[model samples]
Target: MRFISEQRFDNGCLEREFTLGDIPGILWTPSSSPSPLILLGHPGGMNTMYPRLASRARRCAQNGIAAATIELPGRGERPRSAGAERARADLRRALAAGEPVDEIVDRLVIPLVDRAVPEWRSALDALLSLPDVRGPVGYSGGLIALGIRLAVIEPRIAAAGLFAGSFVPRCMFHEARRITIPLHVLLQWDDEANDRQSALDLFDAFGSREKTLHANMGGHMGVPEFAGDDAARFFARHLT
Candidate 1:
């Protein structure tokens, strides 16, 4: 896996191409006048540049939101067979640590996510520093986003969108109430990676005065069902 190339877009934003563990994805700045900064995450074994997150970023940019997706250290341009093996080992450790096999992806992946936050924050700073840029931070996938919400103790986040994500860092659940910013969650009705109960638990935890939960009748990998106008609406409410 490698970063194939980069392209500059309409607003002096750069679009870069990357090869994930298998697939290809683009990291770009939408041509919107004033864009929001979004940090996209992929499901376990999936690429951050996956369409699930890319399409969402594209939509946000089209709707005047500036977005960017950072590839995870081992899964994107720096993929390795050993990386997959390491992920499996982490999963086992998470289970032994009392985290359910199902939740291992959310719990054990924390260290990887912790390592990725600085990269994400740097990317966020670059995107937000652009003129007229002032969008909230949002995330997809499960572990990475929750990790950002947990590990990074910054107050600049205006809003967050967690799609098919979980609630970890047991200590941070109460902080959800303090976020004050609007939060929107998209939970697939038939998810295999993260269960519905987990989503409900997260919803119950976020209890934001302004929160929206959208349900899609699809599996964990099924992303389009949760895309389109609703995503724009979520970013609009939070970013715009």
Candidate 2:
């Protein structure tokens, strides 16, 4: 990984912007060394997601855990995917007609998982090579389907904190059944954009014996601060 820029948070956490191959990413390391790592996940768009991501990174730093995230394929400054764009247009039309979007959701989410998972694994390879980042890894945040695939395929990720606020392909339910690591899932009860029953069912599908669901009353962006604290504790329990 090539480090292009660096800065420090007021709390003494170090933030570095870097690139892995063509993918742009950011890494946050706390002032403390030998920190466990958390890989942050989000729905596409790095620029739009930065403020919240920075907040999450600061919290990870406070807890003495390193954190990092990469731009997903076809997001931000990356080349656009015309096929995904077409699938999105199809999704909008299907939604407009009150039609089931199973196929569209599959089309949109599956390929993203396929492409993004490898990039994250590659990022993991590079991040863990650094002296400051060590111990077990945890994954936290949205695009729950991608998180599921990563948790299943990437053995280094010891736990996960999933945000139930994204479209999940049905196939990922089977993949979810393969995940045996600890999981902490946060569901926004009244999220206008998410399917509540599907989120609950997906949670139930996880094969992890140690999974916990925190269903709170809010819109997608309105997760209570205490829930985040709870997730941090969960990671601390498993990763530290």
Candidate 3:
């Protein structure tokens, strides 16, 4: 990982922008050494998502935890894939027409999960090599499908906090059943882009012996501050 630029916050958290091959990413570290790490997940677009990601990272940093996130495939300055674009258009049209979007969601999300999970693992490999970004690692935020795949496959991630404001691919349901780590799923009850029942059923499908769901009444971006506080506490319980 080659760091491009960096800033030091008053709180003693160091934030750095870096690149992994062609993918761009950011890492935030507390002043303290050997801090536990949380991988911050988001929909896409670092410029659009930086405020929330930094907010969440600061929350973790204050608690002596490290945080990091990478741009998803075909987002930001990365080259776009034609298949993913077609899938996205199909998904938008289905959602706009108020038609069932299960198939479209499968097309849109499954490929993304396939492409992103490995990149995340590679990021973890590099991030963990740093002196301060230590385990046990936790993951937080959306896309929930990516979180589920990592929870199932990445043994280093001991817990997860997922934001369920996006469509989940059908095949991920099977993978969800394989996740045995602690999970804290956040759901916005009135999310326009998400199906409430689908979120509920996905929550039910997780095989984690220790799992909880927090549903609040709001839209996708309306996650309350207290929800983030609760998520930080959840990670602290498992990772700290």
- Stretches > 4 Å off in candidate 3: none
Q: Which segments of model 2 are wrong by more than 4 Å?
A: none
- Model 3 earns a TM-score of 0.98
Q: How would the candidate models be sorted by TM-score, starting from the highest?
A: 3, 2, 1
* Whole-model lDDT per candidate: 0.59, 0.93, 0.91
lDDT of 2 by residue, 1-240 (tens): 999999997999999999999999999999999899999999989889999999999999999999999999988999999998899899889888889999999999899889999999999999999999995899998988889999999889999999999999998899999999999999999997888999999999999999999999879889999999999999889987
lDDT by residue (tens digit), candidate 3, 1-240: 999999999999999999999899999999997899999999888889999899999999999999999999987778898998898899888889999888888888888889999999999999999888778999998889899999999999999999988888878899999999999999999998888999999999999999999998769878888888888899989998
Clashing residue pairs found in predicted model 2: none
Which residue pairs in candidate 1 collide? Answer: 35-66, 36-66, 36-135
Worst 10 residues of 1 by lDDT: 143-152
Quote the positional error of residue 200 for candidate 3 in Å.
0.5
Worst lDDT run of 10 residues, candidate 3, spans: 217-226
Point to the candidate with the largest lDDT.
2
